[model samples]
Target chain A: MLPAAALLLVFLTYPLGLGVWLGFTDARIGRPGIFIGIENYEYLWSDAVFWLSVFNTLLYTISASILKFALGLWLALILNQNLPFKSFFRAIVLLPWVVPTVLSAIAFWWIYDSQFSILSWALQQMGLIDHRINFLGDPENARASVIAANVWRGIPFVAITLLAGLQTIPQSLYEAATLDGASRWQLFRYVTLPLLTPIIAITMTFSVLFTFTDFQLIYVLTRGGPVNATHLMATLSFQRGISGGQLGEGAAIAVAMIPFLLAAILFSYFGLQRRKWQQGGGD
Target chain B: MASVAIDEVYKSFGAVEILHGVSVNIEDGEFVTLVGPSGCGKSTLLRMIAGLEKISRGQIAIGERVVNNVAPKERDVAMVFQNYALYPHMTVAENMAFSLMLKGVSKPESDAGVRRAAEILGLVPLLARYPRQLSGGQRQRVAMGRAIVRDPAVFLFDEPLSNLDAKLRVQMRAEIKELHQRLKTTTVYVTHDQIEAMTMADKIVVMHDGIVEQIGPPLELYDRPNNLFVASFIGSPAMNLLRGEIATGGSPSFRGAGGISVPLASALSIPNGEPVVLGIRPEHLRLSDDQGIPVIVAVVEPTGSEVQLIGRTAGGEEIVANFRERHSFTPGETIRLTAEPSLIHLFHGETGQRFQTRTDQ
Candidate 1:
């Protein structure tokens, strides 16, 4: 306990405290500065780039999380069936997650390359498009592209977790429902969905958090580029705080994201976790 | 209520055949139990009746309809699973009414159905509670209520009481039997427990190795089993089977190992020196004063109603005997035990089929 507590204090709390402290001062690279309370935050409140990044962050998180959930749940249901080579397919579905994020991001970089992308090549061969797609050049296209990559990397986590939840449901319930005259869709609506809600809530909360703070895929693919259209809160904070040498301003930007993260956590806790059936004694 | 006729049905999973050529004719409003050991295809047979498993060959008819291709819901059967399988998310009332709701029954009608079932099952107070909040017996009642509310043509129970404690199992067994009597629905139940099969079923279908060994009334099977399997499986303490051969010279007698001999019915006409197995129930054995098969007492267990004694014969064959009168004996004491000649069962050694004697008539 002592060792774990000391490690948390030194690694987690100390860095977090330092970042919060830095947010209040006018500190720069290689220079300690005096306190300038709320100045950096006030400046960020009026900054247009900061606002654009906030919008980008919301759009990226919402769209990516939604896409990840839908595709992940579909994959989970399919994998739950008595398919041939089921374990092999399940393990294959987890490849994107098992690979390092930076490695997958690099792979996606090549997939989205302007001239050599296989997707563009296939489309061109099929006479679907006349010219190459500017995947990372246009703002909207860049945002969508980065979100796609994030969804790809994040789907394995959701799919595997949801597949585990699906397996926990007893097969006897399905047989009972069939005898009760439930059509396939009715079984899903009444039996599968209700039982899977708690797991969905937890998995989606984690997915949303991961998408909201996503930085690696965007950095590798665009560097929040094409007029900063794909700049998430995380990348923008790093860009302003570390790369731009305005340590205090970057810390302030990073600190500003806490309220939204806290909101996500609170929403999942109050809105999703407190189910009536879940609040009971053991069966 | 409906009659179920299963004719020469078979079930195979891949290349592994589970049930082979099984048949039973269930009368309308009859309670039939399929009893066997685990992995003997009793549950699989019940599932095939419920249309949960595809019949590999042959036909199963429910009522007047050949239901081999019919869907489970269309077969008009409701099943109570071993685990109860109550929806954990729904309250008792909702669980009972789910089938009615799926059938597009109106709100008031569905509610009335649930209410009636709740009352019958004594689940009226628990109607608002979830399945997890109920005790095992209460959950079992809710499962039965769910089946009862449907009021289907047939009820299939797949070892529904196996999960409960011994006391709860007995109580539920009686409740299920009473429910069957009150409803008078054509019911087919599956259980590995012979006692459950005996107490609840109007007719018992004893299965072993995926084939129907015997089908008869409870007492018929208890008094006379068709083969060695049914003889050993039906009785509680199980019949004591001794390997021996029939000696036809003079008065017929059974000569077992270690110079042990017992009298056979004089009217028996099996060939001389034909190897056979002799079977007798534990309760049929009585203490002999002078001439009897010699046995050394190994263990004695006295319940309030009877004294159960386990002993070894001179041939080292273990034998069990139950006596209503309380008699004390030391473990190493040698005693002579005997059974009435008419109460004996003889089976041919190679075939395992019971031999007919004059008393069987």
Candidate 2:
């Protein structure tokens, strides 16, 4: 136990301490040894770009998380039914999560490109758009595109999680509903949805964290591009620390994200606890 | 009041038939129990009546309408399942009121229905509790309350008490009988327990291998079983069977394994050396001083009410007899026993069909 504790202290605690120290110091590219207290934090407070990045990150996280949850639940419900080739369809649904993220992002990039993208080509062909539209060139469209990409990737995880929960429910419950003369919607509303709440809450919490810290897909597709409209906290940290060589400012920005992430985790914790209490108190 | 009639119903899954062509006329306010062992299609037959399973062929009618394809909701039937099938999320009140609410009954009307059913089932205190919060018996009461609230044409029970412990099973069995007596709703119950069938059924349908063996009142079945299956299945500790041959003679004595003889009335006509199986209830065996067969007791089990003796005949065949008092005997004790001639049942060994005794006729 002592040896494992020592290892944890070295590998985890030391790095956290170093990151905190770096957040307060002016650890830039050329002036690496400077230690200026609170300046980096003050700069972050007044930074409009940082605030916009924060807003964009929250928007992407909330939208993508909600979209993934809805789509995943619908897909799970459909797949739970007695259908042909159910196992084959389930395997196909998992492909999005299993593929390499970089490859998927690159493929999506080509599909959303302004001139020769397949989606633009299909839209033009369908006469939905008057001309070939650049999906990622416009700021609003780019943010929406990145969110859609995140949703597409995360949907399989949520669906599989919810499917496992759905399978645990006994078939006798549905039969009981039929005997009670429950309509199709009532069975889902009273039986399926109430039973699935715990699983959905857990999966959505994980999805929020994954969407908030997402870097690879956005980097490969947009690079926080189209006038920095799609930049999340992770992307901005990467640009400041690695690209612009402002390591201290980047560290401060990264550290500023901690309070929001903690707030999210606490919110989820209280929500889950309240539900558990409600269920337990009834008994 | 409603009468349920099943006419020539057959059910099949893929190519394997689970229920053969079957028909039953259940009169209004009668409790009919379908009793059989596992894989006997009794539950399947009950589910067909409840409209839970599709009838592959023939017709079923609840009253005047032929309801071969009517949905369960439209058929006005409520079922109490073996596992109770109470919605885990809903309180007992909500579970009882769910069907009424679905039919767009007013809130007060539904609440009244729920309250009345709860009061009848003695479940008013449990109305606010969910299924997981209730005990097994409480859950069963809630299930019954749910059925009663619907006030449907017929009440169906699919082995609803099978999940309870032994003592609770007995208590609940009586409660169910009392409930039926008060409601007098046409009920079709399914179970694997013959005791339940005997105690609660107005008419018992005995099924075996997806075929009906016999349908009659409990005492009618006990006194006159149509076949070997019904004969052995309807009684507890089962009827003791001894194979012997009946010959044309004056006394018509039966021969046993070790050349032991037992007296029989000359009512049955049998060819010389025709093989037959004789069945006797354990309670019918007597310890007599007259000419009797001697047997070595193999095991003795004594309950306060009766003493059961497992013994082997001189022919090395095992037989069991129950005595009211403790016989106070060790294993291997030799005792002479005889069966009442009128109580003995004879069956053709080949066909497993009973030969009616004079009193039976």
Error of 1 at B135 (Å): 1.2
Q: Assess the local accuracy of residue B203 in candidate 1 as a C-alpha lDDT between 0 and 100.
A: 100
Global lDDT of model 2: 0.88
Query: Interface RMSD (C-alpha) of each candidate?
Result: 0.9, 3.6
Question: Across residues B1-361, which tens digit of lDDT does each residue of candidate 2 receive?
Answer: 6999888889998999988888888999999999999999999988888777999998999988788888877888889999898887778898999888888999999999999999999999988887877889899999999999999889999999899999999999999999999999999999999999999999999999878889999999987887788989998878878888886677787887888888887756777688888888888899876677788889999998999999988888778899997778789779888888888888888898888889886
- For model 2 the local lDDT of residue A94 reads 99
Residue-by-residue lDDT tens digits, candidate 1, A1-283: 9999999999999999999999999999999967999999999999999999999999999999999999999999999999999999999999999999999999988888998998889899999999989888889788888888888999999999999999999999999999999999998999999999999999999999888888888888888898988887899999988999999999999999999999999989975855777667776
- Give the TM-score of chain A in candidate 1: 0.97
Q: Candidate 1 on B1-361: residue-level lDDT in tens?
A: 8999999999999999999999999999999999999999999999999999999998999999999999999999999999999999999999999999999999999999999998889999999999888999999999999999999999999999999999999999999999988999999999999999999999999998899999999999988888899999999899999998999999999999888889988978899999999999999999999977899999999998999999999899999999999999889999999999999999888888999878888
State the interface C-alpha RMSD of candidate 1: 0.9
List TM-score (chain A only) for every prediction. Answer: 0.97, 0.93
Q: Which candidate leads the pack in lDDT?
A: 1
lDDT of 1 at B266: 96
Off by over 4 Å in 2: A1-8, A29-35, A124-130, A274-283
